[model samples]
Target chain A: MKKLNFGIISYAHPHALRYASTIAQSRRAKLCAISGDGANSDVAKGEAKKYGAKFYKNYEDLLKNKNVEAVYIAIETYRHKEVAIRAAEEGKHILLEKPIALTLEDADEVIKAAEKNDVKLMLPFNPRFTEPLIKAKGMIKAGEIGALEYIHAISENVKPPIFLQGLDMSWFLDINKSGGGGFMDTAPHGIDSLLWLTKSVPKKVFADIGAKIYGFPVDDIGTAVLEFKNGILAVLTAGWGNPKGYSYGLEIKYYLVGREGFLDVRTAYPDFTVYQDRAEKIYWDRPDVRGIVGSFVTAVLKDKDVPISGEDAKKNLAIILAAYESSRKGKVVHIDL
Target chain B: MKELKIGVVGCGNIFNLAHKPALKNIESIKVIACADIDGERAREGAKAFNAKAFQSLDEFLDLDFDVVEVLTPTYAHAEIAIKALKAGKHVIVEKPIALTTEEAEKMVQTAEKEELKLFVGHVRRFDKRWVQMKDVIRKRNILPMHIRKREVQNLPFPAHYWYWDENKSGGVALDLGVHVTDFLRWFFESEPLEVLGTGKAIKEEAKSNDTFDHFIMVVKFEGGKTGIAEVSWAYPYPSRYGVFYHHVDIIGKNGRIRYTPLDTPVVGVAKANFEMPRFSPLLSTFPDAFERELRHFFECIKKDIEPKVTAEDALIALEIAEKAKESARKGEVVRL
Candidate 1:
């Protein structure tokens, strides 16, 4: 079996390390090269040395390398369209981070490039990879609960990349660079999972978004109610408002209702907490990151459709943008997509 | 320590489950009479309290009770409380002072002109958790910037009940909405400037009523604070009661406070007694807030002081809820 040789573009987003580590340990994937271009270049260089992979000072140089068959692009959000398009044109299968681009036009261009170049464009929506939610999706598909009618999902975190990654994540709070704050960063997970689980398109969105914590220019709290074409009413609350002492720093939960039965799902389930005098310790009972990267690697190797495509992510981004518009205009914004 | 003679009107679910049990625990108050549109429940309630029973408020108001606790349906609150106040009785009314602000104002004015004490049952104000939250915010100067609260329950009544009728009961936006809106106004200590809302019925039983059993309302307060209230009566379907869940998160300038179902330790699995509030079924407990609320009402009547929850405060919450309903209906924000 030939291992898929992978190059990682920029270590700006924290998920870079997860993908790199997964490739390092996998039997079917190889960490062929690492690239850097911005303030995170040194970090990228250090990661390359630690992983014993070739290092490229610029991502284009990495793309120029003939042996790199695939790339996981973890650059900042504003640069997603540019880097993804470049990766696609390089004939490399790409795993793109979420919020595909800042606008629908940019997202469309990236999708067009991927389709034109015949490359698989997958968005790393981690929830789609988690075990419990995967099982929930299977149950919904099997009609375990009758026809799905309503869902209330919440995705919350302790601020952003800073608390989770211990890095300066001020870029995520900048409206111009990241597009929006907590909702923009976190709601994509819930929105994507909702769309996937219900297999429905959104018809309207009404939201109330604001800077509720830290008084940052970008909003820290957002709540949106969406009506789906299938008559599913989904309410999503995404925020960076968890206090310091919460056990699960990243908590995602869902309340699913159907005609016959209901489901209360905690995405961060099968975890344990240890309380000691010095500090509290929390551990995920099973590894959740494995499937996200492994499945993408296998999809590229098998020449099969990726689990979540660029078009699916574009719809997620469209809903997010509609929520912002709804918040701004203080009206329910009808989503055509 | 004198015994305060109290007359309770509208012998319904709340009176039987919350007020009767709580009033029995209070040694300083005695129920002198009970009245209801349903004479059977009124007689049953009188028997439970060892009081007289009457089929009409006109007949009941003539009794020699010092205060009247109006626990009738929300639409009847203003007329009943005003009538009680005019009869020279200090009044204690269940929340949402009236269906409309005009009616709430008339209740307030009548109480003022009659020179009698009027207290509204905004029970969360007396709950220790919320009071402590207020203390933390004020004492620590948390300076709340955004507050989120959600209260959800299975449908407490049958499909044919007034609760399913939007015009009769005002749906969840006015029913459960008032409970949380009152909390938001109290927590922020500022008037709400605008409200944006989205709501739906969601249940097939409510599909014909043209009412929302679930609603999410976003309120912007005067001091640049934000409050979100997501209230629902559409918890688990099939009209099973006794499922209750609530969450509160207060994000402020200096600190954050949150409470979720995970924090609660009590759990029960049963048929979920349909007669009680959703909490009473699973939690197997009624909040002691009811007793504290009754005690405070008695104190206000005795001390001749304003209540912890006043008619004006209730009126403000009702106004916010009404605006929220309008926002949900028009699909736009409604300004105060």
Candidate 2:
């Protein structure tokens, strides 16, 4: 049981901390090193010490480390391709944060780089690890609900990244860096879950994307209606449209209607509200992040295929890009992929 | 004190559930006669109101009624309303004034020529909750960025029922879609600029020449505002009667408001089922709104004022719905 030594590059994205914690707590993986953003090197150094991992000022330096077997790239979305290509060139298995890259061409090049280097590329979509949804997918496939007819999914956040406390996530509001605000950053998870559960491809998409609540340059709210090739119609509304008082950090809901029966799925089910003098917090009982990290580690260690491949994520990205195009042109755009 | 004698046509579900309950509370309006193609239903409805029953439209039109309530199927709305107007009677047709814009326009023209009142039942205008939502947006100067209204009806009718036929019911787009588009137009206070729609028939077995059982319509207003209207009649299985789910979510620059039945303080729990008791928090209590709408109609007739929901408003909603149907068929955006 050889433990995979993992290095995390750039703490710009908050999910980097969760990945670091999961690696440190896992039995078959170790947090070998961490690289910080140039402006926030001290915070990364503190985090590296907390996880008992070495720290590097530059992400390239962490990539150069001989002991690091795989790298979790959690930089800004704009730099995903560059760092992921570099990590692949370093002969390290890569677990890239979602969207794969900003555009389809960049995503294809990243996939090519991973294949050319013979390193595993995995995209961590935590919703794919949800237990009830996994069961629901099985039931749907098993003809428990009959043929699936329609799907209504909602993946909403209370506010944009800029409104996040303690950390400055304003890069998400910049169109150049994050591509789009809420739809780009928050919608991929639901899209990925839909792609994974249904195992179908979207043929056409009509979308309404705009900045509704917060007047950011990037769109904060978007809703896409997709018709899949399997005759399943899915309508997903994703973005920062929920109120600030919504305690659930990420509210993901799905309603699946079939010929015989229907299912209502809430990923954050079995959660409880804890009210205190400081703040009210909702604690979800599902340890989905740990599931994602553990499965990725096992896939790398056993030389097995990753649960969610880059190609699968690229398809999800295609649906998202098509949605943006549909919104811009005010027409139903056919997905080329 | 009954000043207006009302003759009702069509004794279907809507008549028994909405108009009947509403007409009960209006003291100024009297139901003098009832007409239906089915003699039994006509007799039953007439008995309920202690009014005379007529199996022929001509015989019913010959009666001395001041107002005609066209509660029949959507496709028959134009003919019945125009005939009622030509016979010197004010007409109050249910939502979706007609299946086509031309038919609706003819009805409007007939009303103008006859100098008779013609009201379209855009009942949400009188619903206290929706009216209050409009008030909040207006008084607070809230600019709505996106609004979503959804309606799901689990119709208990079999596959061969006329409601499933596009010719008679005008499908879900003209049937349920009109209610939402009209509400969105009223909420935004703007005309629809364009619409993109996608629809499908979830049930494999249904009688329809054309038209889907479910439709998702996106309307862009004159401003940058966006409205999403979703209507579904394709429930997998049927309940004893039926089931209805309606929800409204408004996202504005100033604030957000969500009105859903899940927030109701009332619930019904039986042996194996727990339900919201009411099909919709807005509609289950809609008898009050229906009463208000009827009272408004009576007041307009008495005071010589224009009705709140004019035939023009219903025409605009139908136009949007027709464009949505075209968009759904062509898989493209249809501009108004």
Candidate 3:
């Protein structure tokens, strides 16, 4: 089979940098077009040339490229729906980044557009693919614990002023664009994983979010509680002031307390730790994105069930949307479904 | 060797774990009496240290002791320490010295008039790491360190439960926050110029105190340098209490130094006892800090010299902590 040709939407997100390098080395996919609006186009021009692809200043031009079969939508999270809907309308397969949109209504618009045109929509939901969590999901299903009761997942980073200024795109802290602070940017790793591990849809959410230290317009620290349809209670936390690196302390921890027993996973440990004069960093085995990228490419190639689907993508964002609403309203917001 | 007969007041967790154990390490210091409002706890402490038990403070003060360890709650520190000092006893009280700046000031004045050696247990100053850190700071001038101290217990501590009363303990700000606040000031030897802070009583178990079990304070010193201390005790999830943790990092003009769990040199799979402050008191272990602090306190008494951590220094620490609490309560910067 001819390699499934892939085009990347933008170079805005940090993940896109990794994906651009990985997609070039992929056996099943060929990098075709790299396009977005912004100063990123100049960077994308060189990036596209290296991968034997063209750089389109406009994202729509990339979407119209006949040779590009699927698209990797790696733009700022708030701009997800607008680009995704256009990509879907062009009948392009999409592996959109987490937080498909700022609001569930916008998420719905992208979902309906994909259904109307028939395209595969996959969400990175990265932590779910980690070995420990995959095993935890199997254990929960095998009655290692009777049933899911509560999940506490947290993600923390040290984003001091110097750290934030270092990032080329600080859009993640922009309230209007990112919708919230680190909660909207980083919480999806745990939020999406919690929903996937428990296999439950969220019903209601209550949140306490704040900009405790940096005093950003939106919250850099927050904890949210989600009540799922299966009577599971989940506590989610994402913060940007951890006093160390992005994955400091326990990094991504999932504490699952079921009826019989509990299971805990801290992704940072058992990995090599390196220290600098000023700070330390952790070295872990990078995810075999073959499962994520290859599966999406293969599914698009064989016309089979995509590993992640359009509808499956919306569940996590619904909870995230409800959490933001709950925080704003100072009360639990019920999920529309 | 000039043997010091010590009387320990308030047979609390710190007394049983730190003071009694520390006194035992120094052969020159004999603990003569252990006192508490509750005779049972006092007896328990006395038996461990081979000292007499006294339920009355006056009766306990009559013991043949030359030194007193004011290990009681924050509210009683001023009275007990002052009485001990006025009676011509050299005193080595725990951190904060007293709850208020006024009370601490009086304690300092009384100790000065009596010409007695008075030290507050800012034990970190004795830790080899911090001692060496000070030497480094003297030469290089480390500035703007982010110091965080977190103590998480499995809860229901101080079987006597006096700590639950804000009037008695001043919650965490005066209780645990003082140690960090005191040490931050000690590093620079600079007076606290202003403080802006925030505290929370988010734990339902701590509701009776109506005060915070958590605090994050930013202190600005006279040299335009700053320090942020985040101290909390509200972690309840068993996994979070995996280990009692403390971290201090001083980023210097030339270099930096840090203390973290990674520095412990010992990590075993022992079962964690869900009790006061931590699964185990890491700082109290020999060669850590407590033993060093006690040795320093006794050596100062033998030489008839001022101890490294003096009552006046601790009084300044109390002043800073009170200002931080005020800042937190009023939502404004409290200028000293």
User: Can you write out model 3's per-residue Cα lDDT over B1-336, one digit (the tens) per residue?
Assistant: 667899888888777767777778788888889889999999998898788999998888876678998888878988998889887788888876877888888888888899887789887678776678778778765443333333332244542376666777777777667777777887756677777666655455466557776566667665534455655554333433434446565533333456554332111111223322343443322344788888888888888877887777777777777888997777556788
Candidate DockQ scores, in order = 0.35, 0.41, 0.05
Off by over 4 Å in 2: A38-42, A267-271, A274-280, A284-286, B138-142, B205-210, B262-285
Q: Poorest 10 consecutive residues of model 1 chain B by lDDT?
A: B264-273
lDDT of 1 by residue, A105-135 (tens): 9999999999999998999877767766776
C-alpha lDDT of residue B94 in model 3: 84
Ranking by DockQ: 2, 1, 3
Q: Which tens-of-lDDT digit does each residue in A1-337 have in candidate 3?
A: 5798899888777666667777888887888889965425566677888888888988999988998889998777778888999999888998998778877788889888887898888888777666667777888898765566666676655553444333356677677667778677777777778778767777766665556545567676666666577766666767664644433443666756554444556553345556675556544544635457877887888888876676776777777767777656545467865
The candidate that wins on TM-score is: 2
Candidate 3 DockQ category?
incorrect
Query: lDDT of each model, Cα atoms only?
Result: 0.82, 0.82, 0.70
True contacts kept of 1: 0.28
**Chain B alone: TM-score in each candidate?**
0.92, 0.92, 0.86
Worst 10 residues of 1 chain A by lDDT: A278-287
Sort order, TM-score high to low: 2, 1, 3
